[model samples]
Target: MGLSSRSVFGLVVSVGLAGAVGAQVTLPPPAPRPEMPEYVPPSQRVDEEEPAFDPSSVEFDPIWTLDEDGKVVGPDGLAEIAALRHNPLITEDLFPIIETILEDRAKEMDTKVFVYPRKAIDALTGAIDNFDVRKEDTRNVMGEIANSLNVSEGLVSWLRDQGLITEEMSMVSFNIMQDYTKRTMDQIAASMPDADQLDLISHQSRFLVRLGLQEPLSAFGRLSRKVLELHPDVVENAAELLELKGRDFLDEVAKALKPLDDDQLKALFKEAYESLHGPVVNSADTDEKIEGKPVGDR
Candidate 1:
């Protein structure tokens, strides 16, 4: 079977069968790959007429394979990756380069910072399943998160049915939901016939933006009050908001997530993965089941 967050772990022995008992699996040895040259040119090669035979050789990594009947034939690529987590063979000398080529992918992904409503983000966090490349379920699952944040409610029932969002995570994501709702309310209030209130509300959004540059907590409340004055309606239900206990929550979250930028997270993710799992094989051939056809793409 292919890999996934659910079936990704397995490192134990039995007792009476007495070791670990969990959902897990494995596969065969890999093929050796051809050594890549340091450099070459079209013109230089043609002139020599010499069959540019190579003398140097290096140990190659085996390629994982599968069969027509869908049987995993070779050592699982994912399993190899998993084992590398604790292996010593992967080293700086052997492997080095690793990072996502597309930086903008972060905005495209359905991660929490980008997702709205927050429930969709919760869903992905809760999922633990075997993956099928033919189904391309990971993208679909993530898209659900994006849609929810975007206010596209069509997938709501599917989300619930799929158990994408667990009860615990859903409640956590509700913080995000409430935050968006509050932002929406602010927008609506800003759109009212009252010009002064609209400007005031807009002011809050600006202050929130500028909050990143400001030293934490130094003048936060003052700016917040100014924003409130510009859009006083936010405080119109001060008693209810206070009862709801959402104000401090919002402030706390803003502070916590504010400094975290995409580049930093991307680098960190790659760094951590490399630290645990040998090195990430970026630019390698990734298998994609496109329209039921298995194809390799970089």
Candidate 2:
């Protein structure tokens, strides 16, 4: 079905600017990020041995099977459970990769960010149903920009009135800007903690935020979008995601992989204590195990 043409002209309010084009936006509650073991830094856990997603190897299940009673079992049931994981191919043990990405992003303290005002009327005409996202998202971004004093919706509307923005492009940009803002700004705030955490957040927070708190998450999101976009049949697009259902999907994948090559991966996970994070040569003799065999655990 096509998106409705009716929502293109909806207005957002700006800092007390009622029904104005751009406005200070309020974001919805963010889901809590699950805690992981603090003993090992995320980078050391996954290390470089972990493989990146192989686009060709991905296979998605089609048509969730159901019994006469509509209950699923066996492989079909397993798939129903697996499908709940965002990308079945990517496992939950891979959370470290995300943290690694966040850590890496911290090095980029000067990434350039642009704030666009709003798209003109002609552009906003047909963007209502593209992703089934809420209209208020745009309002929040508009509010963000307006609060930031970047631009206003009225000005953008005037430009559209002047034939600058095509109707189709307006709404798309309207939501796109909102999306960029919603996804990035707070992430930068959250992942990149202020001075408060430094005395406490371990050195990781400083490095990750400077590198780009949003990079790993962005990389994850990109990979997810790419997988679904490339294989629309095997995956759910943002529309079908419903809510933050992707987290559950990843958890199942983690369970599936928890046992595969366990001893080897566990060994590798622990190897960091020596090779990647060896603090002193003498300390190595203190006591440790490598590959289920004792390094010095005599």
The lDDT of model 1 is: 0.32
In terms of TM-score, the best-performing candidate is 1
Candidate 1 lDDT tens digits, 91-165: 434222211211112122222122121332133223112222234474365445333332212121222334543
Error of 1 at 288 (Å): 11
Question: How far off is residue 91 in model 1, in Å?
Answer: 56
* Model 1 / residue 250 / CA error / Å: 4.1
Task: List TM-score per model, in order.
Answer: 0.18, 0.16
Residue 47 displacement (Å), model 2: 52
Number of backbone-clashing residue pairs for each candidate, in the order shown: 13, 29
> What is the lDDT for 287 in model 1?
14
lDDT of 1 at 122: 34
Off by over 4 Å in 2: 1-199, 203-213, 232-239, 242-298
Q: Which ten residues in a row have the lowest lDDT in candidate 2?
A: 108-117
lDDT of candidate 2 over 134-229, digit per residue (tens): 345633533342233211222223334545444433343334333333434444456456535433233333222212212222222223333334
